[model samples]
Target chain A: MLDVFADYMTYQVFEITKGSKLGDAVNFFIYDSLKIFIMLAIIIFFVSIIRTYFPPERTKQLLSHKREFLGNILAALLGIVTPFCSCSAVPVFIGFVESGVPLGVTFSFLISSPMVNEVALVLLWGMFGWKIAMIYISTGVLVAIISGYIIGKFKLEHLVEEYVYQMKVGQNEIESMTVAARLQYAKDYTKEILRKVWLYVVIAISLGGFIHGYAPQDFLADYAGKDNLFAVPLAVLVGVPLYSNAAGVIPIVYALMEKGMSMGTVLAFMMSVTALSLPEMIILRNVLKPKLIAIFVSILVVAITLTGYMFNIVL
Target chain B: MMKIEILGMGCQKCSTLLETTKQAAEELGINAEFVKVENIKEIMKYGVMSTPALVVDGVVKVSGKVPNKEEIKALLNS
Candidate 1:
């Protein structure tokens, strides 16, 4: 279905330019935009439906009584399905902590929820193939678990606000949802995500289209190639300030890869953009002290940078 | 006469609870005073950290999740 649309778009664009470079760019833009938007809508709808089952209440229950390493693993995995709204992060953090979910376990969920979410998976799978998608999810979860475990070892419970401990919230009740309500929530969630991301997707894809048509393949490789040891960290630094969803970022990744950027550098950049963005830090700062937030960001940067270097070496 | 207070910072779930509570009250044919507590300080005064809490009169009946409409109806009736 999409292939036909892409071909037709390409034909239309090429007809005007008679196979010129501008035609190629326009063709690439149309094909990519159509393919990505369709995939994003379908995947986000289905994923939102699945998300209805894994709200913060349910996630708190799942991690409330589990042991450390096991809890971290479970939390990280659960984070993938659970829909995370940053506005609720504070309340959920308090809820989890009050319910006896170890602070570290909560961190794992917090980390993975945004980083290893279905949005990232759908975008990566659509553009980069299943292998990269699978790798990204696994590695993201692994980082979450490991970071949570390490934070657990540090006994940073003191870093959380003192009010959280004193806040005497009652035992939360998880209510069953009707099928209609679930579908409504799914539809709303899909619309919300699409609305927030559509403009970014268009811009990213257009930039990618331009790059694919005009830039020399060796341009980025000369500076950010695997041979450059600093490339991974630099990518992480550059990505942190750019607040974008996976759908928005994947176009850049696609363009970079086509221009000979290493898989490791690209993956590192993607993780940094999604996980360590400045906005996320500001949101989390409401519940966490500056010291703890610093530790969290440092750990994520280190983990992502290491992952990038390792992948570059191996692949 | 009954007072239904829904506590939260007015996120999506809180709005849903508000709607559900209104529907339940209407179906039960009860003239109830419904209040939405959106201020974080006000919510904290209830000793509830988790959002979308339902308070019946002065007592908190539910916290941290949206109760189904049937459950809300039951709470209203009780």
Candidate 2:
């Protein structure tokens, strides 16, 4: 139905020639925008409802006292449902720590929360197939787990700011909502996220359409193609400093992939952009010492770089 | 007299909650003392991990979201 509408708009309403590049790009833009918006709304709404069940307070209770490897895994999984923002990281970190949740486990939750979120998953599914989306999610969770476990093993407790340990966190009652309230919260949350991301989505899709219509075939293949040993690391390096939401970056990912960038390299780039952001690191610096922060970034960079290479070889 | 505390580290939602809560207080004609809790330690004392949280008379009424005016009014009345 959407395809038919896109075709009608492009050919009948706009009157660009049926097979012209402009018509093709316009058609691609319209179809993709409609499809992505629909997917984002439905997924975000359901995810928000799920989130209402897993606030950071409850997540802390779940993670506290669990052993390291298992805790890392659980934390990474919970990170997907837990409602966390970088701005609140300090309090969450302190809360988790004071409640006896291991540092590594806390790190796992932090890493996966931003990286393997519903928005990124939905966007990847919309653009790429489910197979690629699954690959992105699994690898993202693995990186979070492995990096957090390694940090945990290092026993970098002293590296945390002294105040984080000294501070006592009070326990408050978790809010309970009725079914109607949950539904309302979900509705409001979906609207809030869509309002925040729609502009980025439109801009990304437009840029992708332009690239699809105009960029030369195999333009990026020579430099960042599968054969390039350095391509994965290079993509991660570039992506880490360049901060953008998943919505803002997916169109560029589409453009790059269309230009023959390898799947692994592209996925790595997206993960770096979302997961290991500089601003998030800055926020974390409030509690983590400079050394701990450096170690955290380096571990993730290496892990992501490896994941990129593994994907390049496997798929 | 009621004391209402908005707990957050100065994020946009924190301010939004503050404004809505203030408006609700006026609408309900309740004499309330409003405190904006920006200190992380002070916020932690309330045991609220997420913000902006609404504290009515030292008890947490809500956290992690900006409730609407009607909801805030309900919280105030309660």
Candidate 3:
């Protein structure tokens, strides 16, 4: 009976240790997790410097008081430089309105905030290549500009909050500080920001790492990565409802590439998740009514899908 | 204690920074009262050009990017 029990225990151990997936997951958690973490650290440092240079109010002022298309174009341009998302959203929205910037123009700024972040761009360059990074950045800027202009042309002024019109542009609260004060401020805020989302980045990157290291190549090529006619549109559709951001998504993109997912398909998905997340939509509801939000989401979906297809064709 | 704020408009990256920073702190044996500064005005107050910033003891250590647990640990330890 004792001999029988030992045999059963050994069999159980063998079963647990035999699968390749378990080893993959373990190795991934160990090796890939570290790489993802390091990348995130670098991004955090870059973001810190940006926080020190551009404040939301400053960006808002730049985008305020311009022709709709011009302002939207400017906002998209500024969005590339400026940091922060929802925080900038309402403030920029209010600032633009107070300065008579067009609604569509402001939307451009809003759209680009999440999609074309600086850190994500850098990581993409390192992970994929500069060509792809430039492509992503240009396309992101283009989306912001075009979408903003389209909404501006419609003169969707009525969609803005009444309070926004009445709101005055407040002077930046931290302007009087010395250099030391400014540096201190940046460091403090960087820590705060890092505190919130580092884990998710790690988790997402771990998944990415796993994919990078272990996902099957031919399976991916045949399915998600292919230049199939439906691939781009399908990727967009799949990406839309998901809520992972670029930071989390990029590492995964590396994995996807290994798994045979096309760069274009992954990008479409990342764009949707970063720019049009469900949470962002929910927050927007506070400032924008459901109708406006729905329109925005719809437009983004189409734009992202088109972008994906275009990329696959061009690349 | 470290002061941390994530600047991105509440995206997953921002959220990831929060969790990873804490993990870093714990791994390095430090205590921090982390703050999430979601207000763009507040982010601008610190002059953060990027969302999701990391501040240690009132210093802007990282911004616009997420850090891994070990990196966070190093920041705390250093």
Candidate 4:
């Protein structure tokens, strides 16, 4: 029986390799690389445009002594206009406090920046069409706002430094430059991010391309197919360690779904890959206390897993 | 010239605040130097436990949060 299985595996490998030349593989890699670059470039471009035209500093004016709920809503909107990554979220987090922005409101901003971002949206659209992308973005923003409001309602503002409320930083640090200069700033910013994250993109896309080309459709169908309830959380778990995020992972999700993986599992995997990545966690440990960081991660796990289950049932 | 120090481990918010401060300073005609402080030992020197702390001139004015451009400007001017 083992010999039979081995023979079958050999045959499968041979079948996959047959008629597929090195040129074809190279072409596939190049095609996929362009797709990755285009999607990422669009996101980077959008982020730069927003940074140049409407800085997050402007949003500080909105949360000026507003009600917590309203402040959270505005914060989410601000996160939409200002595209910051998890790494840069801290300085602006400081800026919000020094500007008198409320704590609950700040949470909304934090959630929106990482959860519903340009990179995620464009990649989702590239892989799964605009409709799904729109749904994903809208839902993501909503989650940020609602979670912030909930946290605000609990009056967790005291968790912040007392000095934050009384303090002030000047407005001299606002946007100031000509169109050409701003453009340069944006371009340079995009290139910097690209340089940092291109490796992840390449890894994600290359793996996805190979899976697209040769993964066994029947096995994937039997295991991760639409009917398998276990696949959702399993996918989520498998995805968390990969750390590529929504932009890098969505293409793989799309390709896999096309080859018969369930949408719910794929989406859960995507969310896990983006929201609960190991690198994000490593980066997070610098600012957040272990308990608080653990809480944050737990919230994400519950929320994303639940989301996956719901999708499993509905879609 | 005003000197501003931003303390954080290079999170998105810290970087944005730094960018926003630079922009505000340019727009407001304030001459300044902006520096990012990522080392924990250095940040702790200012008694900052949380990240993205801000120091204007030599005094630690903002720690653990992003300050508005205006407020940063005011700190610089003051």
Candidate number achieving the greatest DockQ relative to the actual structure? 2
Q: What share of the true interface contacts does candidate 2 keep?
A: 0.76
Q: Could you give candidate 1's per-residue lDDT for residues A20-126 as a string of tens digits?
A: 77666777778777887888888888988888788777778779978999999999999898876555667778778888999889988888887888778867776
lDDT by residue (A141-250, candidate 3, tens digit) is 89888877877776666775565565544343334447785666567655665565566556655555455445455567887765587777777777766776566666
Candidate 4, position A168, lDDT = 45
Candidate 4 residue A289 Cα shift, in angstroms, is 5.8
Question: TM-score per candidate, in order?
Answer: 0.79, 0.93, 0.66, 0.66
> How is the predicted docking of candidate 2 categorized under the CAPRI scheme?
medium
For candidate 4, write residues A146-170 as lDDT tens digits.
7777666666555554544544444
* lDDT for position A233 in model 4: 72
Which candidate's TM-score is highest? 2
Fnat for every candidate:
0.20, 0.76, 0.11, 0.09
Residue by residue across B1-78, what tens digits does model 1's lDDT show? 889899876578899999999999999898989999875545655656457789999788877667778988888777
Residue-level error in angstroms, candidate 3, position A243? 2.7
Screening candidate 2 with a backbone cut-off below 3 angstroms (N, C-alpha, C), the clashing residue pairs are none
TM-score of 1: 0.79
Q: What is the lDDT of residue A142 in candidate 1?
A: 95
What would the TM-score be for candidate 4 when compared with the true structure?
Answer: 0.66
Model 3: share of native contacts present?
A: 0.11
User: A164-197 in candidate 2: lDDT tens per residue?
Assistant: 8899788798768799989998999999889988
Q: lDDT score of model 2? A: 0.90
